[model samples]
Target: MKSRMHKGVSLILGLGTACTIGLSSLEPASALPWQQLIFNGVQLLQLSNISPQQTVALGQNIHQQVKQNYRLDSNSKTNAYVNRVGQRLAKASNCSQIPFRFYVVRDSSINAFATTGGYVYVHTGLLNAVDNEDQLASVIGHEIAHICNNDLINKLKQTQLAQGAASLAGLDQSAVTAIAYQLAVDLPNSREAEFNADDKGLQYMRRAGYNPKAMPAFLRKLVRQSSAPSFLSSHPATQERISVIERKIANGR
Candidate 1:
């Protein structure tokens, strides 16, 4: 009877030890860090963990596409002027570690866009429309804020994960991909992001020795221009944004 009791106790001890070891092994490896679990049990990529090399490659790819599709002036004077202003604003941005390159598109459209890879493109019409360096800096600062916030990547990944969830729910891969692509391309930022960008852009302009109020002034001009049935009609010039900018300027002091 004593022997049997001892045997049973040993067996229990051994099983407990084995279970503990198994659980330890089941834990995910530290090297392959787990990301935030989202819908459909899909994990989103941690943007901070993303490699710089990958970002550069992505930016370069987008830059090539923009170059191919848009009409950019190759003139040295225009390029130099744009680069000078961009460099100044980029230095004041939160993501100054990333190298920034600016280009002036020859198109007359009043459009400006920033890509994930630290590339900022400004249309000739935008430059022509601005009155001074402060106005230009405000535009650049706003665009740089988008880059600093990693808004593009976040939107892209959010879209991909959403589609992935749909795919797991019996949606075809092609359909999911199509939807994801469209969402990624047309990801309008949230109101919070827009306001944050406006505030940050104001600070950036101030840091670069330009008047922060220039942002609100330029925005007002854009809002007025939007009403004229021009190419600038497609932009976000809602009164809310104007009000936000005005409030920031009012409280900034």
Candidate 2:
């Protein structure tokens, strides 16, 4: 019994480290061959209470590293546009108490990603992909949902617990931060996380007065391509995602 319990705990603890390092699934369950469960079960370990201040400080660390690798979009107009859209969605998010910040990357890839401390990055390519503001809001809303859902904090806590609680040993602060940086800039979240983001993002879209269907519409356009777009490289988006999201829209949840 003791050995069995320890094995279960270890698996859950490992998810935090795996999520942080940007190391995750490649086995798709259904329509998407790329999707897989990072953990053995659906349960995410929320073992610790990470205060907003701790997350903000860690987020700053992660963001500093992000700026070093990617060039920020220099266009004042583009900067304002993405931030403007992101800010509006933040108000409708579950974690509205803290400020949300958005940045635009100069790269022309259809990608957007978020990190702790309410920071989200949008690619110029993604901006060009959407037909209107509502589409952009839905994307940003999804990112906001990631941050607001305590997904970031959960990763950090998992990393800590996997190492040890009392000694403050293991990966050390800098190593963990480095892993988290990669997670923000270049990784696919677990399938469960992706689904939650889809669900909550729609709610935020409706609350913020953006067309709720815009998310599914935008997504359907992507899947129609002869090949998956660059956006799917970082996200686990699949046909299953679209079907589930559409159902949510119908139910108005």
The alpha-carbon lDDT assigned to residue 129 of candidate 1 equals: 82
lDDT of 2: 0.71
TM-score between candidate 2 and the true structure: 0.78
Task: Name the best candidate (by lDDT).
Answer: 2
Q: Report the C-alpha lDDT of model 1 over 1-253, residue by residue, as the tens digit.
A: 0111212333322332232111111123222222222335433333434545555555665565555467788989888988898899989888888888898989775666676658788888888988898888888888788778765655544443333333333333232222222222233554565667777888888788888877777777767763542323434555676777778778863
**Which runs of model 2 end up more than 4 angstroms from their true locations?**
1-47, 163-172
Tell me each candidate's RMSD, in Å, in order.
17.1, 11.3
Screening candidate 2 with a backbone cut-off below 3 angstroms (N, C-alpha, C), the clashing residue pairs are 27-35
Question: Candidate 1 versus the native: TM-score?
Answer: 0.71
Error of model 1, residue 7, in angstroms: 68
Please, what are the lDDT tens digits per residue for candidate 2 over residues 1-253? 0111212334434454553434332222332111121134332222354457556766787777777777888899999989888988999888898778899988777888889988899988899989999999989999899998867665655465444433232333444556667555554566778888999999999999999899989998878878777777556657788889899889888
The runs of at least 3 residues in candidate 1 whose Cα sits more than 4 Å from the true structure, single-residue gaps closed, are: 1-48, 165-187, 226-237
